[model samples]
Target: MNRKVGLFFGTFNPIHTGHLIIANHMAEFSDLDEVWLVVTPHNPHKKKSSLLDNNHRLEMVYKACENYHKLKPSNIEFGLSQPNYTVNTLAHLQEKFPTNDFCLIMGEDNLKSFHKWKNHEVILENHEIYVYPRISSGEVKSELTDNPKITKINAPIVEISSTFIRNAIKEGKNIRPLLDREVWKFIDLMNFYKK
Candidate 1:
């Protein structure tokens, strides 16, 4: 039988604790066998300068997810075109791994801002989407699509964020709890996010 995987795509600038929580939760609660952390090369809406190099981000993701059996990091977007879109990546992944069933796992925060993604409907029409809650926000229409493949999961609402971690690091504050030990060590070794 083919494996069912969830593609959790993001810049993952530093791959913090919240991202790990969501990926693990999706694997455990959703109809997915595992979750692949598809680290994006770039996000159009965010400043590229704020991002760690794609390879570094991938390394951070790998370190953070290494102990989690169901979580793995992929650099699929690294060689792709600039300003990569979810729809295109999904299509490429489907074509590349036709036998695997891939799902889109995202936070409710993205759903709220989904309209901004390119070819959002194509993504919704093709794959299952598992959305974790954002803070106390109630049900809101997914800006991506009205397709029925979207499912809301009652996972932990971890308040940690990469932006906060970067800011803390820049200010010389402790970020041990904000990220995994291996990831923290990697960041320190490379001096990542040092403004």
Candidate 2:
């Protein structure tokens, strides 16, 4: 049987508890062998200036995910071309790991803009998508709701975001609840997101 691996792609400027919670839930409830947090070097849709160095972000993710046996930190996008698109990364991963079946893990908010992504149709055709709910994300439209391959899971919703955490850190506010203990320590040691 082909092992099912969920690709939870994100910038992960700093990995937080919310991320780990969703990943762990996916691993337990979904038909996935493991969930690999694919840390993107650059997200096409997000601002580059707001992001930390890719290596720094990667290290934080590694530190945050150290205790989770099923949650892995993957730097696969670093080797791929700039402005990494989901379709291309999926293709490359399929080629590289032929024995494993790959799935996409995203939030319902992302589903709203899914069509805007490059080659969105091809991505849907090739892989399964597991969408968890986001607090502010309104109802998923018929197009996505009707899709057979899209599996909607009732994963815990945490309102925390990387932007919120970064701003708190920049303002010298406490963000201990938002981040993993080791991740917060790494950020302090490295002086990350400081104004």
Candidate 3:
């Protein structure tokens, strides 16, 4: 069997401990052999002023996952076309890494709206999806919740958001506890999020 890798896609704009908790929990508790933290590229359509540069964000993810044996940082989406879709990324990753069986790691909240995603059906047909519970208001339909390819994992509900962290940093609040040591150091040294 190919190595089962869970792709946890995110912008990771200065990856925080919440992100690490979910990634680590998935790696340890799920059937996945490895969890790659895929750093999503900033959309060209959105104002780039608020989002950190892609390299900076990727570097933060790299630092955050440094000591975790099962965790890895991936910049696979960076090479893809702007405004890339998950289905396309899945296809490209499958083509490039045939030896690895990739799967999607998503939240229950996202699963509720999975139907609206571009080529959602194709994604479900090809890859397994590991859904983690979230403290969100919504009930997933039985169809999606019952999919054989979808597995619900008992991962912790991390409520931390990158937006909150950024805003706290701007206001000079100490958020070192919310982020990894190396990540905090890198961000402080670079003076990021301090508008």
Best by TM-score: 3
Clashing pairs in 1: none
Candidates in descending TM-score order:
3, 2, 1
Q: What ranking of all candidate models by lDDT puts the best one first?
A: 3, 2, 1
lDDT, candidate 2, equals: 0.90
Off by over 4 Å in 3: none
lDDT tens string, model 3, 16-107? 99999999999999899999999999999888786999999999998999999999999999999988999999999999999999999999
The TM-score of predicted model 2 comes to: 0.94
User: C-alpha displacement of 131 in model 2, angstroms?
Assistant: 0.6
Candidate 2 per-residue C-alpha lDDT over 78-132 given as tens digits, one digit per residue, 9 for 90 to 100: 9987767789999999999999999999998999888889998999999999999
Worst 10 residues of 2 by lDDT: 135-144
In model 3, what is the error at residue 135, expressed in angstroms?
0.4
Clashes of 3: 0
- Provide the global lDDT of candidate 1 against the true structure: 0.84
Encode model 1's per-residue lDDT on 69-180: one tens digit a residue. 9999999887778666778788888899999989988888788767667877677778888888887564556344455788888998898878988999999999798889
Which scores better on TM-score, 1 or 3? Answer: 3
TM-score of 1: 0.89
